[model samples]
Structure formats: C-alpha cells, structure tokens
Target: MIKKRTRIVCVTLICSLLLPIQSASVKAADNNGSELSEEISSLADFEAVDELIEQRVDAMTDGDMSEYHELTEELEAHGCEDVSAQEVQELTGETSQGLLNSQIQSRNNISVQTKGLYSAAASNVTFSKSITNVSYGGKSYKVMKITASPKGRGTLFNTGSVTQKYNSSIKAGSLNLLKIVAKKAGSASNVIKLVSLYDTVCSVIRGFKSTTKVEGVEANYTWTVEEICSFIYVYDARVKNYRISASYNKAKYVVSMNLPYLKVKNGKSYSGITHKQYSDWISAQNYGKTDKAISCFKQGTTYNSWVYNVSMTGCKGKNIKNVYLQHPESAMTLGYWN
Candidate 1:
C-alpha cells in the first residue's frame, strides 16, 4: 500500500513539471508567430512604398502628369504625403532647378512648410522606446516609430534647401551665390560677389583700337574702351602713335614735350637732313637740360629715319623720346615714314 502511494506522488510531481514546460513552449510559439506576422507586414509595406516611389520616379522622367498624380496619391495613402520624388531628388543632392536664385527662394518656402509638418506630425511617430503594438487597419499591428529632434529637423531642412540652391545657382551662372546668401543668413562671415571680369574685359577689349589682345596685365576693375585708351596714353610708356613719358627734374615733376602739340614747342632739328641729318638733329635737341634727355637723344639717333622723324617731328612738343616711339605696337604699327 505504501509503494502504491509513493508511485502516485512521483507521477503527480512529473506531470506538474511537464505542464510548465508545455505552457512555455506554447507561449514561445505564439511570440514567434507574432514576430513573423509583423515582419511580413512590414516587408509588404516597404515593397509597396518602394514600388510606388519607383513608379513616381518613372512618371516624373516621362513628364506624365496623370501617372505622377496617381503615384503621389498612392504614396499619400501609404502615409507619406508630402514626399515628392522631385523634392526627394533635390534633397538627395541628385539634381536641382535650372536657376539658383529663384530656386533658393522657392526652397526656403518649401523648407518652412516641411519643417512645420515634420514638427506637427512628430508626436504621432514612435520614439526611442520599443513599440510592441501599432494601430493599423482596425487591428493592432506591431510597429516601430522614430522621432527626430528639432535641431535635426532644422539641419535636414537647411541642408536640403541650400544644396538645391547651390546646384541651381551653378546652373544659372551664379557660382558664388551660396557664399553670398550665407553671409546674408549670418551663417558665414564673408560674402563673395562673383563678377566674371573676363567677360567684361573681353567686351571692353573687343571695342578697343586693336583686335589683338593687349600686351599687359589685366586690370582689377572693369574699364571702358575710352578709359582703357586713356590708361594706355597715361601709363603705357610703350604705346606708339602717342607721345607720353614721365620725368622728375629739380624736385618738380616735368612732362617735357618734344612733340609739336600746340605749336608753342621749341626743339631744333637740322633744316636739311639725311641719316647724318637725323643724328645731328637729335643731338641738337634742347627739350630739357637734363643729362638723361641728352643721353636719350644721342642713343636714339641710331634708329632709322622713320623713328628719327617721328621722334623729331611727330613727338615735337610731347613728353616723349625718339626711342619711346620704337616700342612695340598693339594696333597696326603707325607705318614708318619713307
């Protein structure tokens, strides 16, 4: 009788142990089934979203308005309403509008609206905590939601908007527009103004006295043909057809004129002249009492009769020397006299 009682107690203990194990196994199976269903549902949603995005991308490429609208509607139905494929392209840094300045203004407006929506809808999205259940289709569906910070939202909006502007500005020939706007926004200390001075110079030079490019360093500022012509007259000691030079004498600046500009000039050239006449004419010139002018004329006498005549006759009352006329030419060389 005692043996029979011991067997009953042992059997009861064994069944009690097996019962918890069976219950645990069933609970684990249920958890696994829930996880599988959630994964499948999430994957299906992702596929739908991806397919819709692809269709919209295609529609946009084809410029099909109706198809684009349908794709947008489908995305809206899937809880992504404001995300445009075109906007996405801009945001992703793939491309931008053709005009940068206009694009910058437009992007700012879009960013403001997008930030407002993102801020307003953030509470509906999940946070850092794990989400065990999601409400969808009148049934509890497991979902995970992520929320972004205001700073992050601001960053996203700013980066996307500026990138669009930058790319568009490049297309519009406003290469430094970003730096300019950044200065306006107080985000940057320096503002750059990009003026294609080459274009300006080219335009100016095109109307100059010469078609061949001028032989000199380009000016930092823009210039008109007249201003440039004056510059050549004033600073270009190498210019032909014009007598110009600078000299200092007795601590006073003197623009000695050797050319007969107003007929009040006094310089001596031999009355009857040949090559020896040219050399004698230059040697007798008394335009300035300076040793340099005497030396210049003496050295200049060796040039041909054309140069000698230009120096002696053409530059009679001008602050120029005979050797100065022998300098290189930009326009057609004022042909030498026979």
Candidate 2:
C-alpha cells in the first residue's frame, strides 16, 4: 500500500513538472516569434528612410526653404548629415549640386559601371557623393545625402547595366573599338577564335533557324547576343546588305531631350506602352545620360536589362539593307498608395 502510494505521488509530481515545462517551451517559441517579427518590422524602417531622403532631395530648392530645411533636420536626426552650402561651393565652385552622382542617380539601380567619376575634375562637370545644400527663400537645407548602395545591391557588376553594355561594350571578334557600333574587329578576321570560346571546334552554333515570310518579306529568326556575335564572325562578307533583327526583353536606356528631366523604365517594344507615351508617367526623373565610363547613373528601382537593337551598316554604301540590332526590353510595376 505504501509502495502504491509513493508511485501515485511520483507520477503526479512528474505530471505537474511537465505541465510547466511544456508551457515554458510554448512561451519561448512565442517570444522568439515576436522577436523575429520585430526584426522584420525594423528592416522596413530603412526602406522608409530611403524614400524620405528621396523626397527631401527633390524639394530642396523649390522656391521655399522651409520644407527643405525641415527635411534637413529630419535627415540629421537619422544620421545623414547635410553638407553646408559653403562646403558644396568649395567642392564644385558652383551654386547647388553642379553635377553629383546623387543628383543624376535618383534610383537605387545603376545601369552601367562608373569608373570613379565621383572625384572632382578641372571641368565644371562632376558627380559627387556628398550631401548638397541648396538655398531658396533666404533659407537652405542639405538636400543630397552621402551616396549609398541600394538595400542589397552593392557589387562591381551592376545588373541594371546589362542592356546598356550591349549598346557599345561587347566585342565580337575585334579588339579595337574604332567605330561607334561594337562588332567584329579588324575585318572580323578572328571569327574562328571567337567561336572556340563556346564550342570544342571553331564553328558557329546557331539555334532555330526560322525563315518565315512576314507580310511577303523574308523575316529571319530572332537570335541571342552570343548567336548574333557568332553569326557575324562566320558571316560571308560576299553576302553584303544581309539584314536580321534580334531582340531580348530587358532594361535599356532611353534618351529624350524634350523633358528637362525624364525617367523611363525598361519595357517591351511590342507592348506599345512607354513612360514617354504618358506625360503623367514621367516627370523630373533625371538620370544622367552616361558618365565618362559609359555607365548610366541609375537608382531607386530594379529594372530588367538585356541588350538588343543594334545597327551595323556596310554593304558597299548601299542603303538597300537596314539591319537593326535591338536590345532587351524590361518590365516594371508602379505602386500607388491610394
């Protein structure tokens, strides 16, 4: 009877202990979950900070310094110090940001490789990384902030520039870039060498040769950048004025001087839509054309980029064939708070 009693008491004690332990474990899990949620919430604050900085910079010199000044105070609280107007003048010898990297790059995604143009030069043109101070209505605020890489996009190879590079960067079989168009160097003599990079034998590799007649005209197949380069190397010089169109959908740079400042995203030509088509879509979104290093200053958003739409001309000065090398088009989405 005593043994039985002891056993019952032990079992009850064990059960009692386990109940608290189990409850504690669940509580720990809840605590951990709460911490994880808090961390995720904190990350969003950084994004908010970046957006606020963009807005502050945009309104720095709009004939009223109160807003700009208020933004400066807010930035200072966030650890992004504003460079005084004196400091900016000392750097560029001009009022406002003469030409800083931050001024040209309004987005977080850069479209090309910048070869250290942020350093000042003898010329008035410059691309600095420091915050700028602008004055209006007898008041000034530090509008620009120290240049920073996008949330997680800091690398030597910028993804936004993949399309931009093909515009004038790729070298097929040539070493020297004598002409504006990038193609075979030295009469395309090294076509075999170029092909050897991809295949075992020095031979061109083509995919899906489609010769369809589009409205009575013989339309050749669309090709990738590599395939086109290969074709150019193995192309018969005798067949002059031979034309083909190749396109990829990704981000490419667009240039229009009509708008003082314009920002357009990469898009498909077939979609029949562009930031250009709508005035409401584009305004004051200025990304500098191209730096000395052929890099387009880009930031804010990630846009798709693949190169196409390139034109190479020859054929004994005959205008009969018009070969258009197209770049990749990019797709993007705009978010509205309302």
Candidate 3:
C-alpha cells in the first residue's frame, strides 16, 4: 500500500509540471501570431503610401492642376509635412504652375510683323526686300525676305511691295516670292513676273588657306575677311538676265560689282541658270576652277575666307587682288561687290 501511494504522488507531481510547460507553449504561439498580423498591416500601409505617391505624380504629369494641388495637400495632411511645390517638381519633372506661367508669358510677349520692304533700283532692275519675325523654341528670329517684283519696264518703274507674317520656323534654302504684273506702254496685256529670293547666314571665318596643282602648275589661294556677315541678292530679269549681288554688315569693306548676267531657260525659276553655264562664266573670269577666296577689312584686321567650293573658281595670277569669294545661297560673303 505504501508503494502504491508513493507512485500516485509522483504521477501527480509530473502532471503539475507538464501543465505550466504546455500553457507557456500556447502563449508563445499566440504572441507569434500577433507579431505576424502587425507585420502584414505594416506592409499594407506601405503599399497604400506608394499608391498615393504614384497618383500624385500622374496628376502632375497629366496637367490636372486641381488634382495635383489636392494630392499635394493630402500628402502634407498625411504626415508628409515636408511636401512642397519644389518637392513635387522634383518628383513630377515639371509643375502645373510652371507650365501655366510659361503659357501666360508666351501669350503676352508674342509680337510678329513684317518690318518693311526696302528696295534699290538701278538700270531698270528693282530689288525689293523685307524681313519677317519667326518664333521657335521660345526664341524669335528675323528671317530673310524674298519677294517677286513685276516684269519689264513698268514693274521696274513701279514700287515693289511685300507684307507677310509667318508663324512657323523658316528653314535655310526655303524660297519665298512676290508676284507682280508688268503693264507695257500702249498695251492692255500684262505679263506675270515671279521674283525669287534666297536666305543665307554668314559665319565668322577664322584662318583658312589652300593650294592646288593644275597641269603641273601650283595655284595658291588665301583668305582675308573676318567678323562679318554676308547676304545675297539674286534678281531675275525675265529669262534673259539674272543678276547676283551681295551686301555685308559689320564689315570694313563694301562689295560693288554685279556678277555676269546668267542666261536661264526660265528666268522665273529659282535656279534660273544651268550649272554648266554658271560655271563656264565664272571660269572665263580668269578665276581658277579650284577655290574662290574673298579678302576684306574688318576692325583694322583683314579677314580672308573661302566658304565652300560651291563652284571651283578661285582668283588667278601671283598678285591676286580684288577677288571675292561667295557661297551662293550661303551666309559666307567674302568680297565687296557693289
């Protein structure tokens, strides 16, 4: 009986110890579950914050000013006190306010017009000119103007006028014209004249020289024009006579000479003269068919240049003087041909 009693007491003590251990395991499991739930909630909160930020960025990009402002305010209200206009710009690349400001500024400063028409007449030929203001990429430009004058003596005697406004960018080499009708004396019939003009921009010529060997003879050419801009005036006198003249500004010398009249099948056409005819005339002037150089004075410093070998014609002879190089339809004007 004593053995049985001892056995029962030992079993009861084991049961009591086991109860606390089991209870502790159950409590640990519950704690682990609570931590897991909190982590999941944090992840969800982070996702919500990311989504809000994306929405705000979209609003700014879409130019939804109202929504953009609202989203910014919401971010500040939601514990993002540092949220600011600049911060939004950083996130969205641009702000609605900035775009609006630019639009307003552009609208206010928009001014476009044809400055005026200027003409110089000599030998029954009239060259009418005008400049148009063009806006592009938030900047304004004064582009060259080309207008057609009338044909024959009547149109030459009358005033040539041109007035135009352009909104698009004017590219180099683009042609524009002014149309006129020539009324002959004692005749009721009138002829239509189409005058063509080209645009060229002059570049500063630093230092350039070249030498070539032709038929075992060495021909050397050098440049002497600097810091000047050149403009071209090509006048079409019907189909029989086409003249090319140049004007220079910010220059020390003047250009005074009309190129030899080019005979064109259609004088009204832009490129009136055939290439062969034009080259032949230049070659006959004793100018080498290699390179043409123009020399001029600017600010006490002589500038020499040969813009392009447009036509392989350079001044000849050892004492090459009074030579002018010009890039037809180009800004590179070399000599004074008045």
Candidate 4:
C-alpha cells in the first residue's frame, strides 16, 4: 500500500510540472503573434508616408530655395534622408556611381509626370548608397537622418520642393516654326531664284522633283538651293529684258515673275508653256529664295527661319528646257553663292 501511494504522488508531480510548461508555450506564441501584428502596422505607416512625400514633390520647384524646406520636412517625417540633392546630382554625374557593376535608372512604375506613393512590392526604383546636397528656394539641407530595417529594405523621402526645382531647371528652352520654297524656269537653263527670309541656310531640300500639267503641256526638274540660284544667274544672262518682283513678310516670302515683250510662239504660246512647267519652275526657285531669306536672320532671327514661294508666267517651253539641268553641281551647298 505505501509503494502504491508513492507512485500516485510522483505521477501528480509530473502532471503539475507539465501544466506550467504548456501555459508558458501558449504565452510565447501569443507574444510572437503580437510582434508580427506590430510589423504589419509599421508597414502601413510606411505606405502612407510614401504617398504624402510624392504629393509635395510634384508641387515644388527644384530651383527655388523654399522648395528644400518643403522637401526636408517631408523627408524627416518619412525617414528617408540618407542622401541629399547635391549628393544625388554628383552620384548621377559619376562615371559608374563608384560601385562595381552598379546601374541607375528611374523606376518604370514611377510616373514621370505625376507624384504617387510607391509600395516596395510594386516599386522598381533602386540607387546606390551616397550622400547628397540640395539647394531650393535659396538654402541647403544637410544629411538629416537615415533609417534601416533589420530586413535589407530602406526608403528615402526628400520632403521638400528642392527636388522639383531640379526638375524645372531641365526644361528651359523653346522651339520656333519655319517654311521654305524654290522655283525654276520654262527653258531648263533659266536662272533659278531662291526667295527666302534669312541669309544663313539652316537646311535644304535636294533631289526634289515636282510635276504638274497645264491642260496639255508637261514640266519636270530637280530642285535645290544652289541650282535655283544658278538658274536665276542664267536667266539674268540669257534674258536681259527679264525683271523680277520679290517681297517678304515675317511668315511668307513671295516672288512674282514678270518678263515683258517676250516673243511668244503666238499670243496663244502661253498655252504651250503648260501649267506643270510653270509650277516646277516656281518650286525650284522657292528653295533658293529660302536660302537667301535665311541669310537675313539677325539676333532674334537666328532661331527663326523661312517659308518661301516662287511663281512666273509669260515664259516659253524653249526657255524652260534650258533652265532644267541634269545635275547642277557635285554636292549642293547652300549659302556658297553668298
């Protein structure tokens, strides 16, 4: 009976020890679950901060000093000041960002035109570790702070408008519009007149062939600046009686061709010239006119260019044939005549 009683007591002791151990295990599990929940909550805070930072960056200017204050405040609030504006610029300009096999590029998911929060799972942006300086509205913000997680992840929020200032500096210039034209004559050898706005030739239209028919006559020719000028010089030589009336405006240059007392095959010889030949001649001359006009460009004109047009009537097909040449020069060079 004593042995039985001792065995019962030992069994009870064992049961009592096991009860405490089981309770301790349950408590540990509960603590672990709580920690996981806190981590999730921190992640939520991170996402909210990311959204807010993007909003202010899109609204600020990079060149303005005040922009930096806005960015710094945002960065401080979000925990991303590992680098500054100056640092970012310097790093970007580096030969290789001073790292072995490193690459830098804007995240594909990031919208270049708009600001938005980025989630780590969704974000594609990455950059090397570096220090940076930023000037905005007129001040610089130094290395404020840096944050890291036990995990190999980090976030940098430049809360100020200084980032925007940098962006604005990249967009400083403007564009202007221009037009050009060329004309040639009835006899292919006739002088090609280029009526243009400025004197300097920015560009030229070469190996151009335009065709048109006036009821029954056909005309064609290769058009270029050099050829057009050469045609004009030829016409001045062949027809001493020929006269040119030209004028220009800010937007257009017009040349009205009028050669009087010509020997028309018949007064009806106007029909023999054909509309196509006249149009071809006018087109050839317009290119030369454009070259000449380009030379007149002044300080403000340097950026502006020309739209040129050339037209003529009362010239014969014999005259047109002489004006059109197979190849006028080896390589067409504009402004060479000047």
Candidate 5:
C-alpha cells in the first residue's frame, strides 16, 4: 500500500522536474496589444488553470468540468469570473436572456446586449492546505489542493470582436474554429463538421436598412432563417495567404464568431437592399396600416450553393430593424453587405 500523501507529493515533484521550463514557449505580449505581433489572448489564463489542475488533483473530482464550476464560483467571490462554453451555457441556458448588457439569444447566437463589445472584463485563490482523496484509474490518491493566486493572472475572460486565434484556430465567445480556418488554408477534407453540428439561426435587428427583397413585388415577412453554411471568406485585409503563421500577424485574424447584429439608424439604412431567392412566411398577421414598429424575420437565399440569411422587420428605423438574417457555419467570415 502507498501513503496517499507521499505518493501525491512524489508525483508532483517528478512532474515538476520533468516540466523544467515553467514559462510559455513564446512570450506573448499583453492581451491588450493592438498590433499583429502582440497579444495572445487567454492562453495565460488557461495555462494557469492547467497548472492548477496539475497540482490540485484533489479538486478535479470530475476533471476540468468540476474544477470549472467550482473555480468559477470562487472567482466570482473575488468579483471576477472565467467565461467559457460552460459559463455561456449557464448564464444564458434558457430560451433567451440578457447578460452583461448583451442579449444572449441562445447557445452560440448572442444577440447584442451591449453595443461596444469587442471590450473588457474574470480571478483568485486562497492559500490553504488540505489532503483530499483524488481518484485516478478508479483508485483514490490523497493529494493536496493547490489553488492559483488571482493576482498573477491580470487577465479577463472578455467579449468583443478582436481577432483572437491560437495555434491556428479562431475563437469567439465559446466557438473554436480551427478546422474552418484550416479549410481556407487549403485542405480538402475538413476536420470540422460545422456544417453538421449547428443549425445557424440568423436574425436581423434592422433599424436603418431593409433586408433582401424577394423576386415578386413585395413580400411581408415575420420568420426565422435557418441555414447550414460552410465557411467562405471575405477579408478587410489584402493578404495573399489567409493562413495564419508566424510570418503573419496572428493578432490581425480577428474573425469574430459572435452573432452579428445589423444595426441601422432611422433614415440611415444601408444604401442598398439585397434580393433573396425565397422568403418563408410564418406569420399571416400583417396589420393593415400604420400601427407600430415590430419584429421582422425574412427567409434566406442561396449563393454558390450556400445559404445566406435575409430579413425584413416592421421597425421604421431605416437603421435598426429587428429581423433575422443569414446563417453561417456559426464560423466567422467577413463579407461585404453586397
């Protein structure tokens, strides 16, 4: 029989010795850096959490899942929290809700609860000693709980539309889109089946502009557009190779996967309105006359065999109409409104 405390200490010591280099392979700049060669996002936070996991085998009853929930609670006690898939799911798990000034429409579709997102805000550990039974291989080992000091991780699990990618994957909210990016980098079979997993629900919140017009005269609509889109790209930059590498500014790959809201101001709608192939009418209720500004949901159109979301809403603001637009693979790609 092994002394639980003794075995845990020995393993920790050995692992510590094996990983001699405690720092990151490449020293990344602060996450706030605006230049291409700067900012590595939340790797540091993840790394810290990882290190804690390595040390605190006792607290990982259910592995990262357990630790994530427990640690988030502790972090909240310190006025900070880590936002991940789990967090997003917990905070906005219901049909739809508002969170942190933004409307979390659903799973991956976050309706804008706040305007300026590409923005800021998560932390801490208390020093304590306790030996708990940590299970491994269906057996229990006694280990000490090791907690991280939040002071060291002066980082936040934030939201916004900044280009945040890691190891060739673009991440937004809880979405990690490496395979989709890889496809653009020129690979035949996609590692990602984004086309399979998600049913992208694209909506519009048009106030200033009109959505895609149908082939006929004028179709009044109130419906949701659902599409299965694979990634086709558009970029603000003129890069010959969209593939991210050390040669390119990784920070410049700001492909936001967050659900986008097409904001238009009253009388300041987009100069052009797109034409859609089909429009599904879910609501037969089109009030006869000038009553009030309400919700609009238009169907979608197909381009290159892929569907794009289109919308129409009753809001008078040519700028902001509440209509749902197109579906993406839920992967982010830049496109011109045209």
Candidate 6:
C-alpha cells in the first residue's frame, strides 16, 4: 500500500511539471502565429504602396491627368492619403517638377555668343545664341527665341548673366522657357580686403609680448596670429631645454597671451587648461585691436575658428607680408610649431 501511494504521488508531481511545459509551448505557438500574421500584413501593405507608386509614375511620364486622378483615388482607398508626389518620385525614380527643371538646365544644347565679356556696371548686355535640337519627352524640339537678363547679385566690379534655352514645340511661336543663369566669377575686391586684414593682424602680433615662464624658463614672447589661427601655440624655453605647449581659442579674435600656461615637467607637458577655461581667458581680453583690424576691411567679420569673412573692394593699397618665425624649440616638440 505504501508503494502504491508513492507511485501516485510521483505521477501527480510529474503532471504538475508537464502542465507548465504544455502551457509554455502553447504560448510560444500563439506568439509565432501573431508575428507571421503581422509580417504578411506588412508585405501586403508594401506591395499595395508599390503598385500605387508605379501607377503614379506611369501617369506622370505619359502626362495623363485622368490616370493620375485614378491612382490618387486608389492610394486614398488603401490608407495612403499622406503619400505625396515627391514621395512617389523618390520610390519610382520619376522626375518631379524641380528635377525636370534641373534636367533642362544640365542637358539643354544651347550655346551663347557674347559680343564681349559682360561688364559689371552695364545695365544689360545683348547676346545671340545658336540653339541646337534637343531630345526631350521622346520628341525633338528646337528653340525659336530667347529673352535674357541679369539674374544674380552683381556688384559694381562683378556681374551675372542669364541664358534661356527654350523648346518651341510646346506652344506654336511661343517659347517654353528653360532659364540658366551663369554668374561672372571675379572677386578682386575681396582679395584686397583679406590682404589688408592679414597685414594688420600680423603687425599687432609682432608688437605684443608677455613676460612669462614657459617650460621652466622666462620667455619674452606671445602667441602670433598665425599660431592662434592654427589653434595651437608652441614656444621654447631655450635656457631650460624644455618645450612649452598650449592651445588657444582661435575664434575669439583677440586671444589673451596669458592664462592656462603649460610647462614641460620631466619631459611631459602638463596643464590644467580646459577648453572652456581658455575661451574664458580670451573673452576677458580687449577686442579693440581686433575690431580695428577687422574694420580695415570693407566687409570683414569673424565667422568661426577656421573661417574669416573678408570682402574685396579693390586692390589699391601696398601689400604687406604676414610672416611668423618658427622657433628653434619647435624641432624638439614633435612637429607642433608648424
């Protein structure tokens, strides 16, 4: 009787374990079925969207307004009401209106014959063109007449010209305009302004110096405009035979010669200077000199650490050199001075 009781108890325990295993298996099967249904639905949606896009492409290529409206209705019925013309073009490689305009500009066979180079001060420059046959929309179209004008920002020293390539077949005796404006490339004034700004900054750097210890030796030197512009400053303490390395904020325009100084300690340079610390140091300096330097140019502005906005008025003043001497300590500092 005890053996029979033991057997019944074992069977009950086994059934308890088996029940959970059976339940887990059923749950897993349910999850898999749900995933498969979602996947199938997603695929169906994709196929429907693709078909609608193709229909739109065909309609656009054929210029068929009726077919385009029919496709739009079908797309709306399929819950794709938010699909746009741009989206359809993106999916099907079909050309949008902007793309059509770009194609006309890039591929049109139109040549301009100017009497001479267009003058900046001239109100208008008349030119004639020989228009060749262009293949567009599977039809050969020839340009009949073109109306040209000035199109871009033109200063008294620089000018822009516009040329139109037209397809006369669209409307009989009327031009279907394909406008292409080309600007004359010249910045004689900007070059002059840049030269003047560079000369002023160099002169300022040449005159300024700070009495400070660099790499454990006293040095009477300050960072140059070029070094600051390059975003790194290096000077040698010739007496100590050690090199000093410090980085400055190039964007500040008038960077301070002091603060966050580094020295070569035991052949390794150490500094407590963070980027924010150096920037703050620069911010404390007087910008009067920098502002004066920039004012020497017509349209001079500081854009960032790397870009300086310098405009050209005209090259009239004598050119001055922006020179910096490479320190002898530069050779020992792993090519940092350059």
Better lDDT candidate (1, 4): 1
Model 5 ranges off by over 4 Å: 1-13, 19-67, 71-115, 120-338
lDDT of each: 0.22, 0.22, 0.24, 0.22, 0.22, 0.23
Measured over all alpha carbons after superposition, the RMSD of each candidate to the real structure, in angstroms, is: 39.9, 26.6, 36.6, 35.6, 24.4, 34.6
lDDT of 2 by residue, 1-338 (tens): 24633543465456446433121000001211221111111001122234344444334313346765665565444334433323323322222332333434654553433223222111211111222222334643222222221111121011111111112221223211111122221232111111101121113223201221111101111111111110000011132111111111211111111111111113111111111110010111111111100111112122222222222221111111222222211100000001
TM-score of each: 0.16, 0.19, 0.14, 0.16, 0.18, 0.14
Question: Which has the higher TM-score value, candidate number 2 or candidate number 6?
Answer: 2
In model 6, where do residues sit more than 4 Å from their true spots?
A: 1-44, 83-338
Q: lDDT per residue, candidate 4, 1-338, as tens digits?
A: 24633543455456446432121000001211221111111101222223333332323212343654564454443334333323322322212222111211332442422122212311222111211222333643111111111111112111111000010111111100012223323223333343211111112212111221111112223212111111111001122211111211111122222211111121221212211111122223233232332223211131111223222211121121111111111101110110
Give me candidate 4's TM-score against the actual structure. 0.16
Residue-wise lDDT of candidate 1 within 1-338, one digit each (tens)? 24633543465456446433121000101211221111211111322333354344345434687977775665544433342323222222212222223333654744534333333322321111111222334643222211111112121111111011111111112111111111111132222222221322333223322222211121111100000000011111122111111111000001111111111013222111111001111111221122332233234421111111111111111212121211111101111111
Q: For candidate 4, what is the total of clashing residue pairs?
A: 80
Candidates 3 and 5, the one with greater lDDT: 3
lDDT of 6 at 190: 19
Once superposed on the true structure, which residue ranges of model 4 sit more than 4 Å away at CA? 1-44, 62-64, 84-338
